[model samples]
Target: MKFTKFTGLLFVFMAIPFLTFAQDWHVGAFLGISNYSGDLTEQRVDLKYTRPALGLLVRKDINRYLSIRGAFTWGIVAAADSTNSSKALVARNLSFRSNVFEGSLIGEFNFMDLDEKGFTPYVFVGVAGFGFDPMARDQSGNWIRLRPLGTEGQALPQYPTRQPYDLFSFSFPFGAGLKAILSDKWTLGFEIGLRPTTTDYLDDVSTNYVDQNTLLAYRGQKSVDMAYRGDEVTGKLTPGTYPADGTKRGSPDHKDWYAFSGFTITYRLGASSGWGKVKSARCPVLRP
Candidate 1:
C-alpha cells in the first residue's frame, strides 16, 4: 500500500511540470520574403526580392520578460545575371539558387506584459540550423560534367554532370517585430530577420568567375556537339579526364555557399477563437 501511494505521488509531481508547459504551447504559421546574404551576395545586383515562407512554431513565455520560441521555415533565395557584359564576365551567368530548410530557437523579451496588448515590440536572438542545397541547372535539365571522349557509351545515364552544392551551417539569427492581437484568439504579426553564416563561397567564388552572371547556359538548352572519349583504343572512363564536374580539386571552377534573410507574417493559435475549447471537466484545477 505504501509503495502504491509513493508511486502515485511521484506521477502527480511529474505531471505538474507538463501542465505548466501546456499553458504556453501555441501553434502558428508565418508568410514572408526569404532572401540571401554573406558571400552568396557578392555579385547579386539587388539585395532584396520577395519570397514566401510558411512554418509551424511553438512558443512558451516563461515569464513576462523572457520566453523560448522554436520554428521551422521552408524558404528560398536566388540571384542571377550579375554581369551585363558577356565577354568581361568574371562571374558565371548561371543562377545561384538555394532552397533553405531552417530550424531555429529564439529568446524573446516582450516589452508589454499584457496578453491583450495590440502591439508588442520585442527583440530576439537565436541560432538557426539551415540545410541548403545550392545548384545551377541548365535548360536541358542535365547536370554539366566534363568527361573524356568515347566513354559516352559507357557513362551512367546520370553521372551528375553538374553536382549539387550542399551547404549545412550554423548561423546567428536576430530580428525585431510587432505582434498585434487582431481578436481575442488571433494575432497577426510581421518580422524582418538577418542571419550571418560562416561560409565565403556562397557566390561560387574561388573560380575564374567573380560572380554568377556568365553561366547563362542554364537559361536554355542547345545540343552543341562536343567530344568526349575515354579510350586509348577505347579508354576506360577514368576520373579527371574531360568536362570535369566542378568538384575536382585544383579545378578553376567550383561551387560556392552563401547566407540569407527573411520577412514573415505569422498567425497565432489559442483558446481565443479559431478552434473550439475543451470541456471544463477535462481540465481539473489543483486545489490546495
Candidate 2:
C-alpha cells in the first residue's frame, strides 16, 4: 500500500510538463537542404553535395517562451574524394551517397515572446535517432551498399577489435532560428540544425585498409574492388598505388556529421484555456 502511494506521486511529478494542456499546439512542415561533413568533406559541410530534405513537425508550447517539438525528417547526403582539389585525394577516389531519416524531440526557447512581440529569435536542442545506408556506384555505374562488404576489415578474423557499425545511430541536434507571427493562426520561421553522430562510417571510409587479398578472399571480389580504387582512375597503376594494407584510409579520430536547414510554417490549432489575455470586458482586438 505504501509503495502504490509512492508510485502515484512519482507519476504526477513526471506529469508536470504534460500539464501543458493549457498551452498552444502547432503543426508544421520543414522544407530545406541537407549536407554532410566527413572524410570526403574538407570543411565542416560540403555544399556541392547539398540535397533536398523534407520534414513534418508538431509543437506544443509549454508557455510563452518554451515549447516541445517532435519532428521526422528525410534527406540525402553524399560526397566524393574525386571532388577534392588535391590530386592525391582525388586519386584515392572514394565516394558515397546515403539517405538519412531522422526523428527528433527537442526543447525550443524563444528569446522574446512571439505572442507579445510578433517576432523573436529562437534556439533549440534535441536528441535524435537516425538511420542511414551508405552506397557507392560500382564500375558498372550501379549503386551498391557498403556495409555488408566490410570495407574497413570489420568482422574479419585477423582484426577482432574491428566491429561492424550499426546503420542507425543517436545524434545530438542543436541550432537556432528566427520566428515571426504571420497571423493569429499562423507563424513563419527559418531554422538551421546540425546533427553530430557517433559513427565514423557514414561514408564507410574510416580507419585503415584491409589486406586486399584477404578482403578479396573473404568478402569476395566486390569487396576488394570497392575497398580500394586507385587503379580505376590511373590506368595500369602500380600495384602499391593503393594505400598499402594497414595504411590510413581515413582518420578514425574524427566522426561524421549531417545537417538540415530550412523554412518552417506552423498553424495554431487553438489557444489553451486561460492562456489568452483577459479582455477586461474591452472591445475587439487584432489577431493576437
Candidate 3:
C-alpha cells in the first residue's frame, strides 16, 4: 500500500510542471535570404551569392524565457569562382547552384519577457535535415546536374573511396533574433541562423582533380569538360593533358555551411492572453 501511494505522489509531482505551464503556441512565416559558404566562395559568407529563402514555423513558449520551435525552410544558394578577385580562382572558373529544403526543431531562450518588456532578444540551437542537388551551367547555358557526372572521379573504380555524396545531410542550426510584441495576437521578429552541415559537397567541389584520361574513358567527354574548366579561360591544358591525378581542386579539410537571415511574423494561439506565467486550476492568468 505504501509503495502504491508513493508511486501516485511521484506521478503528481511529475505532472505539476505540465499542469502549471501556460500552453502558448505561435505559428509564423519566415521571409529571408540564404547564402552559401564553401570552397567556391571567396569569403565565408559571400553576399554576391545571396538568394531568396522562405519558411513556415511553429513555436510553443513553455515559459517567459524558454520556447520550442519547429520550422521548414526552402532556399537557394550559389557561388562562382569567376567572382573571386584572385586571378588563380578566376581562371579556375567553376560555379554551382543548389536548391535546398530544410526542416528543424530548435530550443529558444529569450532574454526578457515579451509581455512585460514589449521586446526581447532571443537565441536558438537545433538539429536540422536538409536536401539539396547541385547543378552548374554548361558552355551551352543549360544547367547540368553535377553528381551523376562524378566530377571528382566518384564513379570511377580506381578511386574507390570517392563515392557520390548523398543528397540529404544533417546540420546544426544556431542563431539569434530580436522580437517585438506587436499585439496580444501578433509578434514580429527578425533572425539570422547558420547551418553547418555534415557533407562538403554542397557546391559539388571537394578533393583533388581526377586523371583526365581516366575520367573521360569511364564517364565520357562531358565529365572531362566539367572537371577541368580551366579550358574556358586558359584555352585547355596542353591539349591531351590536364590537371593530372592528385592535382588540388578543392580543400577537403572543412565542410560546407549555409545561412538564413530574415523577418518573421507570428500569430499566437492556445491562449495568447495567458502568455508568460504559470496557470492556476481555478483561473487562467491573463497578461496585463
State TM-scores per candidate: 0.58, 0.85, 0.85
Query: Once model 1 is optimally superposed onto the true structure by TM-score, how far is the C-alpha of residue 125 displaced, in angstroms?
Result: 1.0
Candidate 2 has which clashing residue pairs, if any? none
TM-score for model 2?
Answer: 0.85
Once fitted onto the true fold, the runs of candidate 3 whose alpha carbons sit more than 4 angstroms away are 1-23, 234-241, 274-288
Write the residue-wise lDDT of candidate 1 on 109-172 in tens digits: 7788536345588878889888765544444555333122111221223433433333676667
Better of 1 and 3 by TM-score: 3
Candidate models: Cα lDDT each:
0.50, 0.88, 0.88
* Sliding window of 10 residues with minimal summed lDDT for model 1: 223-232
Per-residue lDDT tens digits for candidate 2, residues 1-288, read 999999999999887655545247888999999999999888998899999999999998888899999999999999998777767667788899999999999999999978777789999999999999999999999999999999989999998999999999989999999998887778899999998999998999899998888888889999988988776775433434556689889998989999999999988875533213435435877896
lDDT of 1 at 181: 61
Cα-based RMSD of the predictions, in order?
Answer: 12.4, 5.9, 7.3
Model 3 clash pairs are none
